[model samples]
Target: MTQDNVPVLTIDGPSGSGKGTITRLVAQRLGWHYLDSGALYRAVGIAAGWADLDLSDASALVRCTFDTDIDFQEDHGGEPRIIVNGLDATDELRTETAGAAASAIAAIPEVRAALRDRQRAYRRPPGLVADGRDMGTVIFPDAAYKVFLTASAEERAERRYKQLSEKGVSVTLPGLLREILARDARDANRAVAPLRPADDAVRIDTTGLPIDAVVARVLALMPAR
Candidate 1:
C-alpha cells in the first residue's frame, strides 16, 4: 500500500490497558507492521539514564534524542529488540525504572518534537498498527481507525502485577496500584500530548472484558480488509 493508502490503525491508551497486546494481535492478524511507540520513549529513557542526564533537562534530552540512533528489530523468536546508540538494550528498556524515566522524559516538549519524525517513519507499505499514549490524537491523527482502550485503575494494576510476577519480577499489588495511579496522573496531567481519547476514536473499556472480546470489538470497527 502507498502512503495515502497505508490504512494506519492507532490504538492509544495509558499504560497497562492491554493496548500493546491488542495492537500486536491486530497487526499480526492483518499482516501489517507494528509500532510500539512507547518502546521508543523507553529506549530514549534508557539511553539518557546510561548517559546520566537529568530527565528534567529538556534541552539536553532533546539533543540526546536527536543524536540517539535507536533501532527496533525482531529476534528469531519474534520478540521485539531495542538497540540504542549501536548497543543492544532490549533488556534495559523493559525494566520498571526505564518505564518511569520514559514517562518523565515523554512529558518534555522538545524531546517529543525530536522524535516525531522517527515515529511517523514506521508507516510502511502494508500499513501499521501504532500503540502509544497519543498515537491516535497526535502521532497519526489521520489514522483510518482509532481506538482508545482503557480499563479501571484496579483492573490495570492487577493485570500489571500478574504480568510482572510471571516474568519473575517481584512486585506487590499495593505497590503496583500506586505506580499505575502515579503514572496515570503524570500522563494525563502533562501539558504535551496528554492522554485523552480522540473525538473520532472508538472507546472500549476492558475492565470486565476478555482480550478476545476487546480485539473483536476493535476489529468490528475496522473497514473490511
Candidate 2:
C-alpha cells in the first residue's frame, strides 16, 4: 500500500491514562508500525537540556530538535526502546521531569511545526498506530480509527503511582495526583494544538478496566483490514 493509503489508528489521551500501553498492544495485534509521539517531544526536551538551551527559546528548541537523532527500536517483549543520539534514552524519557519538559516545549507552535514532518514520516505502509495527546485532533486527523482514552484524575494518579513504583521509582500518590491535574490544565489550555478528542473519535473510560479489556475494546472499534 502507498503511504497515503496506509491506515492509521490514533489513541489520544492524557499522561497515565493507559493510552501508551493500549496503543502498543493494539499495534502489535495488527502488526502495524507504532508511533509514540510523546517520546518525540521528550527526546527534544532532553536534547535541549543537554545543550543548555532554554525551553522557552523557540528558535533554539527548533534547532535542537533538528540536530537531535532519535529513533525507536521495538523490543516486542515490552515498550519500544527510545534511542536519542545513539544512547539508550528509554528510561530517562519516562521520568516525570522529562514529561514536564515535554509538556512545556509542546506548547510552542514553532516547536510543534518542526516536529510535524517527523511525526508524519512514521506513517508507513500496512498501517500505523499513533499515541499522543493530540494524535487524533492534530497529528493524525485522517486516521481510520481514533480513540480518546480517559479516566478520573484520582484513578490516573493511582495508576501512575503503581507504574513508577514497579520501576523502583518512589513517588507519593498525592503528589502524582496534583501533577496530573496541573498537566491536564496546561495541556487543555495550551494555545497551540490543545488536547481534546476529535469529533469522530471514540471515547473510552478505562478507570477500572484491565489492559486486555481496554485493548479489546479499542480493537473492536478498528476497521477491518
Candidate 3:
C-alpha cells in the first residue's frame, strides 16, 4: 500500500500514561511499524546537550534535529531500544532530565516541523502505531484509530517512580509529581501542536488498569480488516 493508504493507530497521552507500552504492544500484535515520537525529541535534546548546543536557539535546535541520527530496534522482550549516533541511548532517553529537555524543545514550532515528516515516514505496509502527546491531534489525524490515554498525576508519578527506582535511578515521589504536573501544563498550553484529544478519539484512563487490559482495550478499538 502507498504511504497515505497505510493504516495508522495513534495513541496520544501525557507522560507515564501507558500509551507508549500500549502502542508498542498493539503494533507488535498487528505486525505493524511503531513510532515513538516523544523519543525523537528526547534524542535531539540529548544529542544537542552533548554538543553543548543551546536549547533556546530554535534554528540551531532544528539543525541539530535534522543532523542527528536516531533509530529504534526491539529487544527480545519487544521493548524498544533507542539508538542515537550509532550508540545505545535507551537508558538516557528514559530519564526525567531527558523528558524535561524533550518537553522544552517540543514547544518550538520549528523543531516540531523538523520532526513531522520523520514521524510520518514510519507509516508503511500493514500499518503504524504512533505514540506521543499530539499523535492523534497533530501527527496522525488521518489515522484509522485514535486513542487518548490518561491517568491521575499522582498515579502517573507513582508509576514513573517505580519504573525509575527499579532501574536504579534516584528520584523522589514528590519531585516526580511536581515535574509531571508542570510538564502537563506546559504541553497543554504550548503554542505549537498543544496536547489535546481529538474530538473522535477514544479516551482510556489507565490509572489502575493492567497492561493486558489496556492493550486489549486498545486492540478492541481496531476494526476488523
Candidate 4:
C-alpha cells in the first residue's frame, strides 16, 4: 500500500495489561482489520516445539518463521481462529506453555526481523488495529493514533486468572502474577525493541477503570472516523 493508503492505530503494553482485549473491541467498533502480533510469535514457538527444534537455536527459528504459513480467520460470530501450517492451533496457542515459550523466542532479534514484513502487510486500505509489545514504537511508528494501556501488576494478574479460568486453563493467581511481572521485565529490558510508550502515544492506566470507560477514553483521543 502507498503511504497515503496506510493508516493504522497501535496499542502497545505488557502482556495481560488488557491491550489485546481493548484493541479487539476498538477494531470491532471501527470495523477495521485486527492484528494480534503476539500470535505470530506464539505460532512460531509452537511450530518449533513440534519440530523438536531447540528454542535457543536462532537460525532454526528464523527458518521456521519463513516456512510457516499462518492464517488468522474470523467467522461471522467474531471469534478468531488461528491456523498454522493447515492445523488449527487456536487452543494450542493459548496454553501457558505456549505463552512462555513465545516470550522466550520473541527475545531473539533474528526472529523479530523475519516477522517484520508479515506484520506490516496487515496495514491495508481500510485500516488496522495492531496490538503487541512494540507495535507503536517499532512496528508502526508512523501510525495515526497510538495508545499504551497499562494497569497495576496485581490487577492485571487477576484479570488474566479470570480469563484463563473461563477458558478452562487452570492457573493460580499467584503464579500468574509472577509470570506477568517477569514477562514485563524481559519485554522492557530486551535489547531489540524494548516495550515502552512511544513519545507521542497517549497512556492510559486501567487499574480501576471499566472496559467501556477505557474504550470511551480511547475513542475521545482518536482522530474522527
Give all TM-scores, in the order shown.
0.95, 0.97, 0.97, 0.96
**Tens digit of lDDT per residue, candidate 4, span 64-152?**
99998899997678689999999999999987788888988889999999999999988887889999988998889999899999999
Give each model's whole-structure lDDT. Answer: 0.90, 0.92, 0.93, 0.90
Q: What is the number of backbone collisions in each predicted candidate, taken in the order shown? A: 0, 0, 0, 0
The lowest-lDDT stretch of 10 consecutive residues in candidate 2 is 71-80
Angstrom error at residue 111, model 4: 0.4
By TM-score, highest first, what's the ranking?
3, 2, 4, 1
Error of 2 at 181 (Å): 0.6
Name the runs in model 4 displaced over 4 angstroms. 1-4
Candidates in order: C-alpha RMSD to true structure: 1.3, 1.2, 1.0, 1.3
In the range 1-225, model 1's lDDT, one tens digit per residue, is 577678899999988899989999999888989999998899889888889998999988998898788888889999778889998998777667888999999999889988898999999978899999998899899998999999999999899888888888888989888888999999999999999999999999999899999989988987787
User: What lDDT score is found at residue 177 in candidate 3?
Assistant: 100
- Name the regions of candidate 2 deviating beyond 4 angstroms: 75-79
Residue 134 in candidate 2, Cα distance off native in Å? 1.2
Worst 10 residues of 4 by lDDT: 1-10
Candidate 3 local distance difference test against the native:
0.93
Candidate 3 local lDDT, 1-225, one digit each (tens): 689999998999999999888888888899998899999999999999998989899999999999999988979986679999998999999999999999999999999999999999898898899999988888888888899999999999999999999999999999999999999999999999998998889999998899999999998998875
Question: Lowest-scoring 10 consecutive residues by lDDT in candidate 3?
Answer: 71-80
